[model samples]
Target: MKKPVIALLILPFLFFVSSCNRGKAADEVNGNEKKQTKQLDTIVKKTALTIDTVDYNKRMVAMSNNDTTGRWPVKAPYPLPGALLPYNRIIAYYGNLYSTRMGILGELPRNQMIKKLQGEIAKWQVADPTVKTIPALHYIAVTAQGAPGKDNKHRMRMPFKQIDTILSWAKPINALVFLDIQVGHSTVKAEVAELEKYLSLPNVHLGIDPEFSMKNGERPGSKIGHFTAADINDAIDILANIVRKNKLTPKVLVVHRFTQGMVKKYKEIKTVPEVQIVMDMDGFGDKVLKKDSYRSYIYREPVQFTGFKLFYKNDIRKNWVMYTPAELMKFTPKPVYIQYQ
Candidate 1:
């Protein structure tokens, strides 16, 4: 009876030890599962960080359009974060709010202009379907005048109230605003400095017209003007400074060009991560002439990006019709910026 009683006690102790061991094994398994989950989460975060570069490469490929010329995606350093180019296409209405002859932005009534711009945006969306199309009001903040202004610069600076009006309009539609400068006899640095207040805004960008740059002692419309690489670099420097100071996203700088002489030493134009440079084909003509001009000036001497302008009255004067978004998309390396005047 004593031996049986001892045997029963030993059996209970043995069962307890076995149960303890099983519990320890379960705890170890759970600890390992938690560690594995943490490691997987880290890997997912790493993948998320690389999405910007991957998307940039894909857009470059799409912009290339399988061209054999090798000039479409001009090799350049990747832009800093929050860049607008190559990701979204900009459709801008070019004009001064005061002049009806400049471009569509001022040609129509306020309500009518926004409605027209929205229609154009929709058309581009349908044509591309992949890229997002955004609207812009490209205001001529400093317009080149036939007569010399008070400063003898032959450029009229618009009032701040007008720029404020543009901002007011852009706010409701989420549209970008471009302050275009036709420097006339004045320097780019001077004109750009005057507009620094507006340019400091997040949505306000810049456009410099080489067509009226006027380096020599002649009037703006007397001859087609030019801007050297050095002049363009000055504008870039100012924009970069503004971006860093305000902790703003990158700014887009559009340089208008049609002839080879319009932008001298195009190869030497510097592009910074803070500023995106676009060499725009601003001449208005029939489709063939415009394409040839783009091939000669914009395509030959590559910039960070390219833009194409369509004149409502001028483009149709010879061609009898405007080039549709579908037709323009067929060009090599597709223009990411479209301006209508």
Candidate 2:
């Protein structure tokens, strides 16, 4: 009889233990679910900057902060033009021609070049007062040791006289200029430092030629060099600081993308809310086919601004279809500048 009573008491103990275990398991499950929910919330918050849309052609939409109530946020419009300006049709007067001379002559006679370039600017102004001239900086040579030259011998550095000439010509026109630096043997930061004076100018800009920025034993034109996302970010940081110090309008940094690998780190290129960066499509080929290339490249990339190059004599197709100013305005991401070759 005593044994039976003990067994009954043990049964109650077992039931109580089982109930406790069940409660503990339920609490653990609830805790795990809360953690998963928190993780999902963090991921959604981090990806807030990314645009989410099924349509590729539609204008990019962004989230904006809410008004005073801070309850409902609004969507912001896309910043760039979706329809790029047909650069070939845009009038080329003064600054346009001078920009072309950048690569050919590092420095032209200031008196003659400026006078001629300014006259072209005046003529264009007369034709259309509202149109702004997109200025260019010419690429002279790489800082590397064995860049190809007109002669058989290697050409490495740009002469001081050429730098001086470019600066002198730039001062009067109140025009934007770019100091085209070929990063060969030297680092981009070093090259920028060497031309600090020019970069300091309000109207001056910077251009990098990855074509010449190859590692040792690499030859220009045979294969293009790569720029890291970090390298581009570093350059932008430097340029942004300079622009801020000078209290100038945002500086323009131009990058040429002829292949997929040229600017692989393009996303790493910093976005200074103030500066304008242009990724120019530099390939020369069929007009109709090239348009497809442009759409693929521009739409896929993170860049908002783009530039197109038109060869005056070399392009086989004449009377190419181009977007008018009105059409250009319709772009979801509008291009503020245009370039001609």
Candidate 3:
């Protein structure tokens, strides 16, 4: 009877000890999780502050032409965590893979073209040592065609393989890739949806050429085409959704505009933090003409950012010279994105 009593007492003691150990283990795990979460929070805050420092706003004011008007710097919403505009200068090479006549991206062999791009990047780096220069391959994924294909869109879509090739090249260099759309008769919404898989990537961006939008069913190249603010908004909305869905950094959207009609109702274009919009001066001419075009369009109608395009052949045809980075930097709100064709 005494033995049985002792066993019952011991059993209760063992059970109590086991319960305490389990509780202790749970507490330890919870403590570890809390510590890890706190560390992660600290790192994220530090990164955000580093990326969006006070200097970004200061630089914007400096770029603005000392205007009392609030429109110069465009009081758009601050971008989400990983925005790049006004922070780094993008030096891009533009072209389509099918035709070498389009631009330098396809004009030369891959190695030679990349070398040439690196040289240009060096020049810009030397010109503006403060801002880092990032190289980009701006591929024309949708090309406007003279003859309407079976789809009757008046545009040809490059196969996925070519885009894959561009991505493959970009990986080795850590370069950004921009898939440009010339939407011939197709809408921006439709064309952009097709490239969703690629654009979901963090480094991939977007460019829309109003010069070939061709909204009136007219043949592309017959006359300069136009895109309304609504058309541009379609792209912005899509990009914003992609960024949010994939938990990616903000994506850059380049809008090519050399003339007033190329982009219409610029004021109505909504500015979202998820996408950075650059109104690129898409003309090729002497320094005087190029500057005039930029001031007339980009400067007067301020967007979130600005871009300037340089044509290797057309820009120098008139003056036999291209505008140096130093000279181009003198413009009010200097271009943060520079494209060479």
Candidate 4:
């Protein structure tokens, strides 16, 4: 009888010990998760601080009178200026061939010409060895001026016939291709619907041009139409969903901003943890703004990744500058991407 009583007592002790250990393990796991969450939050906050407000009108005014760096407003808590960050690896730009052609003659053979252009891009990889073999992301711009859609219904448009050639060529090279839309008469939701066919492809991304999204009577270059932070966030949400459904890597949403007003509602933009958003400072000119001025005014916005553009002829004379890649590599907060025109 005494032996039986002892066994029962020991059984309860064992159960108590096991329960205590399980609780300890659960606490440990919870603690680790909290730490990781805090780390990610810090990174997101830092990225948000890097966005700056650019004023094109002020810049143009400055440029007309030969004021090189344009006029950037003064702000507080200045970060160390200069090329303090090396941009990210994959870089892209508006297609020079299509952009230039559309700008001048206002027309081109959309289908055949794009295919030939893709072949030319393949040749460029070999011709310019310095063009960064890091497999760039290309944004093919579709506008009303060229490749007009049937019945004037913009949303009915599809990727140009030559787009397949580019896609095929890019696949072999391990590059990414994106369809960029100016969205003159379409909504963000509408444009995404048109682009749904390409979402299944692994190496494709998306870009939106607020520069071309204007109200009635506004021209592309007039800076009349701008996207609200909500508009941008909505587009990001749609892309994130598509990326998740297709089991693809995070989709990249590229936004071109030149001034503070362009991203006025930046603070209100929603943050989607799944997607990577890049805001590029798309300004053109030769004169360098005071590196400190840019950091204080522009690079201080809330964003995940930052981008910079170096015009082959405009930003750097002789297609080169004193700032070496090594020096560029030394930036404290490196740029996520760099673009060369």
Going through the candidates in the order shown, the clash numbers are: 0, 10, 0, 21
Residues 169-190 of candidate 2 have per-residue lDDT tens digits of: 5556555566656675456776
| Regions more than 4 Å wrong, model 4 | 1-88, 96-133, 144-158, 290-298, 316-332
Q: Write the per-residue lDDT of candidate 1 for residues 27-90, one digit (tens) a residue.
A: 7756655665565555554343332666788898888777787777878777766789888999
All-Cα superposition RMSD per candidate: 13.4, 16.9, 11.7, 14.0
**Higher-ranked by TM-score: 1 or 4:** 1
Q: Give candidate 4's TM-score.
A: 0.58
Which regions in candidate 3 have their CA more than 4 angstroms from the true location? Answer: 1-53, 65-69
Candidate 2 global TM-score: 0.57
> Whole-model lDDT, candidate 1?
0.87
lDDT of 4 by residue, 164-183 (tens): 75576566556677666667
lDDT of each: 0.87, 0.50, 0.87, 0.51
Between candidates 3 and 4, the one scoring higher on TM-score is 3
TM-score of each prediction:
0.85, 0.57, 0.85, 0.58
Q: List the residue pairs that clash in candidate 1.
A: none
After superposing candidate 1 on the true structure, give the runs of residues whose Cα lies further than 4 Å from its correct spot: 1-51
